[model samples]
Every structure is written in C-alpha cells, then in structure tokens.
Target: MKIFIKTFIFLIIIIPLRAYPQACCTGGAPLSSSLGVISYTGENLVIDFSYDFNTMKDLYAGNSQLNDKQRERSTNSTILRFTYALNNKWAITTVLPYVWQEQTVRSNVGKTVQSSSGIGDIVLLGQYAILQNKKNLVLLAMGPKFPTGSTSKTDNEFGLLLPPDLQPGTGSWDGIGAVSYSRFGIFRPTLSLYTLFSYRYSFQVGRYDGQQEYRFGNEMVINIGLTDSFLLKKWILNPSLQFKYRNTQKDENNGSSFPNTGGSWMYLVPSLDIELSPKIYLHSNFEIPIHTDVVGTQLVTSFKGNIGINYTLNFKKNKAYKIKD
Candidate 1:
C-alpha cells in the first residue's frame, strides 16, 4: 500500500514538472469542476448533469478596472459527468460538455456578434484514493483532454472564422492533475471542510483547419470550502461557501506569447445542495468575482452559476461511508 501511494504521487508530480507551458485565460473550460472524492468503497456509479452560465462584461487591465463595457461575452454550457468507483482505491471520472458561446462588440459602427454552438472538449480522469475513512478522504486524479469539440464555427455577421476563445473547442490536447483533501464532521456532526488544487497544461498544436497553431494558456485552480447541513420540514439542505483562486499563463500563438489573454482571479462561490432521496440529489452554485488582474487589457467574467442533479447507483451497496453526491 505504501509503495502504491508513493508511485501515484510520483506520477502526478512528474507530469507537471516535466514541462512548464504558459497558458491563456480566456478559453473557459469546466474541467476542474468534475473532480471530487466519489466514494470510500467500490462498485458505485454516480451520474451528474448540469447547466452552467457565465457572463463577462467587465474589462480590466492588470488589476485596474476600465470603464469600457464595449464587449459582452457569455457561454452557456451543458455538462454531463460520470464517476464510477472500481474499488476502495481506484475510480474513473468523465466529463462531456456542450457549449454555446457568443461575443458582441459595440462601437459607432453598430454591434457585431460572433457566436457558435456545438460540442466541446471531453475529459477523462483516473482517480486514486490516498486515504479513505469515515470522516477523512484524500484523492489524486490525472487525465487527458480529448479535442472532440467543433472548431469550425464562424462569425455571425461576417463570413470569417471566429477566434479561438469564441469557438466551442480548443484544437489542442491538454493534461490536468488534481489533489484534494476532505474532512467531514469537523466541528459538528454535519460540518465538513475541503480543499482542492489542480493544474492544467496545454500542448502547442495545429488547429483542425491546419491554418494556425495555437495553445491556450495553462491554468491553475485552488478551492477551499466548508459545508454544513440543516434540516427543514424533513428535508436535508447542505449549504456551502467556497473561495476559488485561479491563475493562467499567457497564451502561445504561433510560438509567441499572446498579449491580453491570461491572468489571476479570485471568486466567492455560495452553493446549496438538496438531498431529494437516498439515491437522488440536487445542487446549485453562484460565483461572483472578488478580484481580477489580467496580463493586459482583457474582458473578464463578472458572474457565473450552475445547477445540477446527481443520481447514484451502487453495485455493492455495502460501503462504510457514503459516496459524495
């Protein structure tokens, strides 16, 4: 068991240390949100489906806010995720997202819009539980992002192709690694605290059109949160508050760093989880940006929200702890 744990840590650390690729910030992909401690035991399957909406109307330049609200960008994403535990120590998670993105620029020449809708990238992860107990859990996961989304969407007003950020998919292959620790019943029987850290690296690759080679900026995210439960009218309500910090490196376009594309951000996320039954759950969260500092002048997200449902199917039905819903 010790050997296996050391080997898993080595594998995760080596991937990020082997290469350091600077990444961009504008390409919004919900990869890190898919990871969590599924179960303490085996033979459990969890299906999660969610819809996320993100809007960016604020413009900033290196921590300084600009008065320009000329550009509005938004992404409406539908995501379906699955987690299956093979045993107490091994599991798999998959995320498939479909996105509709739009960007509108306003000027004296009127408004011009670029939009597209199609399937986005797919992520597959292999997860291992480092520690599993009644109240404590640690997880490590690494995965590959397959470039399966549509990149051929064009501008609505003009016949030109849209930029990479406006497209539903990035044409590059990427790698991600994550680690998380959770402690339940911290102070009370229903209180829990968790922290998660993840990093993503993008590979420089040619696009599907084979016209331009670009790489989205690598991204890093850190989340710390606490949850507590309350009972109301025979309903179990779990309310959580999380602080998220994200940083992205500059994007590489044709082997050169792109300006106004990457930076750091901090957000406050307040969420609610409702236990519908033993096998069903519902969740929703809203994210509000508390701070933003970009590499240069860039449009940034002001708000985002997500609503989802979770259904769990247990093959064994004989686990010591409940798998996280």
Candidate 2:
C-alpha cells in the first residue's frame, strides 16, 4: 500500500514534464488582451481574429472495458479583437467571443446515450499599459463574462443532463483580473511572468431546479525564450511553463466534492510565426500532456496539436498631391 501511494505521487509529479506543444490551452501561454509587444510606433490599429476547434474522445479509464460506456466532447470558438494606441503611454483593447460545444455520453449497459449542444458565454476585457520601455514592461487587464449563452438544460441531453454552457461556462456574474511583466536580458532572450484571478457568484435556479455555487481557483504562468532567432530572420521559438491551482468545491445536496482537482503542468511549446510577406503569416504549435493530476477511474484528457493563420490589414497613408513643376 505504501509503495502504491509513492508511485501515484511520482506519476503526478512527472506527467507534466513531458513538454507539450503550446496550443490554445493545455500547454500554451496564458491568453493576453494585448496584441503582443509593440515593435513599432505610431497610432497603430489592429483587428485580430481567429477560430479554434477541439475534440476529445473515449475519456475515462474504464471506457475500454465498459463496452457502451464512453464520453466525447467537441468545441468550436471564434474571437474578434481590436486594439488602438492611446499614445505611447497606454492602449485600449476589447475581445468578443462566440463558442459552440457538444458532449456525448454512453451508459455501460449500452442502453442509453446522451448528448448536448449550445452556445457558451461571452466575455469583454480592457487593458492598460502600466510600464513600457526598450527592455522591460508591465500591463494590467480586467474583464467580465456575461451569461449570454444558453443555460437551459433543454438545449442538451434530454433536458436531464447539464448543458456544456452550464457545466463549463459558470452561469453567473464573473470577473477576471490579470497582471503581466516581461524583461529582456542583454545576454539572452526575453522572460515573462503572468498571474490571473477570477471570482464567480451563482444564480438562483428558479423554483424547480437545484441551486449550485462554486468558487474556482487561480493560475500562474512563466515563459522563457529559449532562442531569439530561428530559420534565418523570419522565425522565432519560445518555451514556457504553466501552473494551475484549483480550490475544492462541492454539490450541496450530494456532499461529494473534487479535491486537489488542480495540478501543475509543463510543456516545451515551441511557437513559430512565419513572415509570409508583411500582411500575412502562418502560425502553429503542438501541445502534448507530459504530466497531469486530472486522472482517475472516470476520465482523463491530454494536450494535442493546433495550427492557424493570421492576416494584417494596413490602411494606406494618403500620398501628397504633386504640384506642376
């Protein structure tokens, strides 16, 4: 029994070290409201947009033996963001997101299969530049997640199961605050640190439904640039590590709860942004779960691959009228 306990602890500590690819979540860097560090000056305006899709299949340890017992999930997300320079001292930014998710579960007896689908919540954020210079920086951001998604269980699984929006989106008023700093060393590459905090309050579920409330946890991330250059002058690589701490929460009636549900994770996440002309570029990353504590008899998930594109639109400056010589 003692040996088993020690082995379990060892697995938990070693799993997150395999260096997963830096996908959107999983092993990637924390989400930032900033477009990236300012490499140029002027009243620059940028409109950044992207789409992401993810799917998970056959989740859980007993799924293989249970025949019909299985779980699957898929998600599609779209984000539209805008940034404007309020002089060199500060800037303002906003992000609008739309998400669609689907989940399917099968019973062990092969007697029943359940599924749900719907839109998720929407979020808005604002950012301020607290400090900026040639080699160091600091920034702050705050935002709210609105209950714009479908909370009605009718949208999913026979009106009996919880919808993805309700299960993951936290159907309540919530706020997020973040602080980030980065520094460049003369002998090496840039290093960055980020911390995020979130708070949520549950809502009353009318008369017939049960009331549920939960307080999520906090997250911290650190990133180190392994190399400042790659493949000549058009590509760069960065490796980073991220840690998440989750607080315990429970179902009031059941008295069952998830403990230490949060764990630390690490990944190599090498990102490449290629310059395809000045207006278009290609970006991609692969995140693999090296270690995770989200394991058990029920289900487990790991990191995967992500690839995408980016386009920049530059408004042309008006040319001076030529006078006859």
Using all chains and alpha carbons, the TM-scores for the candidates as numbered come to 0.88, 0.62
**Tens digits of per-residue lDDT for model 1 on 1-325?**
9867644554453333113211222444566565544654758888989998888888777888879766777888888989888888988988888888776666543555557888888888898889877788888889988888767777553345666776677866889898888898988988998888899898876764676788888889999998888987867898999999999888888889876778898999899989877678898988899998888677777888889998889788656343232
Which RMSD does model 2 reach against the true structure? 12.0
User: Lowest lDDT 10-mer window, candidate 2?
Assistant: 316-325
Who wins the lDDT comparison?
1
Q: Over 4 Å off in model 1, which ranges?
A: 1-28, 208-211, 319-325
Candidate 2, overall lDDT?
A: 0.40
- Number of backbone-clashing residue pairs for each candidate, in the order shown: 4, 8
What lDDT score goes with residue 34 in model 1?
52
Taking every candidate in turn, the Cα RMSD to the unseen true structure, in Å, is: 12.6, 12.0
TM-score of 2: 0.62
List candidate 2 segments past 4 Å from native.
1-41, 55-69, 111-118, 153-157, 161-168, 185-210, 214-227, 231-264, 295-298, 312-325
lDDT of each: 0.75, 0.40
